[model samples]
Target: MGEKLKLYGFNNLTKALSFNIYDVCYAKTAREQKDYIAYIDEQYNSERLTNILTTLTDMIGAKVLNIARQDYDPQGASVTILIAEGSMLPAGETQLAHLDKSHVTVHTYPEYHPETCLATFRVDIDVATCGEITPLSTLDYLIRSFDSDIITMDYRVRGFTRDMNGRKLFLDHKVNSIQDYIEPELLRRYDAVDINVYDANIFHTKMMLKEVDLQNYLFKTDVYELPPKTRLEIMNNLRREMIEIFSGRNIY
Candidate 1:
């Protein structure tokens, strides 16, 4: 029978231990007072802990594991080790069982208009299950349903500004996203555009709003407001509906 083992915390460290089964223990520098490695050792038995850590590392496909003492630890340095006995677990089948909650505070820039309180909030969604859909795909669906115009927007990939004929010009273009495009363009107009895009793994979402310089008498304004609780509730409902739609399909 396959052994059922569980290990908690220790981000990439868990994966490293699984691959280097020979390494009995390892240490991770603590960010604050929370020593993750020490915590794991305190929680589980030595043998079971070793098995679980090894399994998790194998499942995640790690290369070499390292041990480091936290620089800010008041109690001094501590090392963690693990031992492996069997083959590693499959990486693909692993699912995120839980997610820690985090919050982002919005601050207005000096140029921001005080009449309109604009705030940018970002929340990360951890994948708890492995299926046909990925986190990025899910985020795309959410963004598309939320705002379609966001997908196609002109942006400045790169370039420099010069005072040509007392006019500020920016060389820009309509690109898919940040990483995918890199070019330059010159513009004689000033406009503010707000954009939101997902990162590579859909692990993080980046939102940007900046004013472009132009020499035209006409001015354009773009504003983005944080969604209210009601809108957020609706979004949650929509996500649930989408999940139900995909779950109902029969692959066989």
Candidate 2:
């Protein structure tokens, strides 16, 4: 018979041998010798089994070693088996197989942004649709649809915000310290634009002119009727700009 076998700890191995549970015992080759010595010292009942274990270790080209009881606990132990030379279990398959296959809809708590509407759609699809619509293509569509005066889109880091009078300001959370590279000229321009810093980490800022005058211009130009794809483009541009600014190497 091709060795009917099971893997276990030193204590179990000793017990199995003492009770003549199996014809042979095997252990990992890489385990420490000191561990094996310690295990032998601990189990008074298995003193006779030491010679057998040592012989088995040599036969299997494995070291006889001690292993703590904690190592076998639910959260502590991890078991992996190699089936053959080139074939083995898939990565993450063990955990994935144990998961219950049930649809669960997670709702956001009221404490978070109340106005934000977000949902995740889980689909087992082979390909993504995003690659089909490039960001530049989306931007081109938006620009062509909207009037220049009504919808002005520019990329900038989201940082400081100023009051209507341009005196009071708020800084973003991540901005640790103000640096000299943030030029006085830039500050002056920010003052002019009534820029207020909201979050230091969020790099991009999208400014939409929601006033009646701007809305009237958008209506007049017939650009307000742009598709959802065009709107998504504008939003994505802002996101990209933010990501770039946050990841930029320049510290100042």
Candidate 3:
């Protein structure tokens, strides 16, 4: 690593990472859609989300001071964890899993098309921290944590910190693109795009699966279950949905 920056005082720059991960699955029938929704809800319940956030805090060398999680009545969960730069709690001492300066939060949304049984599972996560630790440190782990078919990430550094000579530094680390933080092996599986504003200290990266396997996008249905023409139609629909989501617009 390069020599650490000589800051006159505490590094006050804040780095925030926000992510929207989408999992698109096609359910051939009404019952299949319902089952898929239930499955996603159960699989990503509050307890599981809490555990994931806890692990993220640990991976970034942060301590959790407080944790508040709730399971929605219908079909969703939300977990918010406050973290700080320090050691974890004692093994038996259970308390909030966050500190004042940092926090991690995740919320899930499961919905299906009213007409077609096209189901989508979306997870929104935000990690913001002040001081030396960066939210970028957990990017890859977060991506692999969920069933991500398309992903959009926004990373921004705010405010300024002072160096030894009282010079203001907007960014402490070097980052030309958010892709700089993603592992090349993981990147190879997706077609990625970068829209960065270098002068403003902001970076955005969007990724969509380069190749879609019909079987992977089908929930509670086998490839052989559908006739060749029908399978192709459903495949096209799923791909269209993913594209719309990735582009944040309706093209179909």
User: Which digits, one per residue and each the tens of the lDDT, describe model 1 over residues 82-135?
Assistant: 212122222467743322211111111111112212111111112221111111
lDDT of 2: 0.22
Kindly indicate the candidate among 2 and 3 with the higher lDDT. 3
Top candidate by lDDT: 3
**How much does candidate 1 score in TM-score?**
0.17
Question: What is the TM-score of each predicted model, taking all chains together?
Answer: 0.17, 0.14, 0.93
RMSD of each: 23.9, 31.7, 3.2
Of candidates 3 and 1, the better by TM-score:
3
Task: Please report, as a residue range, the 10-residue window in candidate 3 with the lowest summed lDDT.
Answer: 91-100
Each model's lDDT: 0.23, 0.22, 0.88
True-structure RMSD for candidate 2? 31.7
* Stretch of 10 with least lDDT, candidate 2: 14-23
Candidate 1 lDDT score at position 151? 22
Candidate 2 TM-score versus the reference: 0.14
> What residue runs in model 2 are displaced by over 4 Å at the alpha carbon?
1-176, 179-223, 249-252
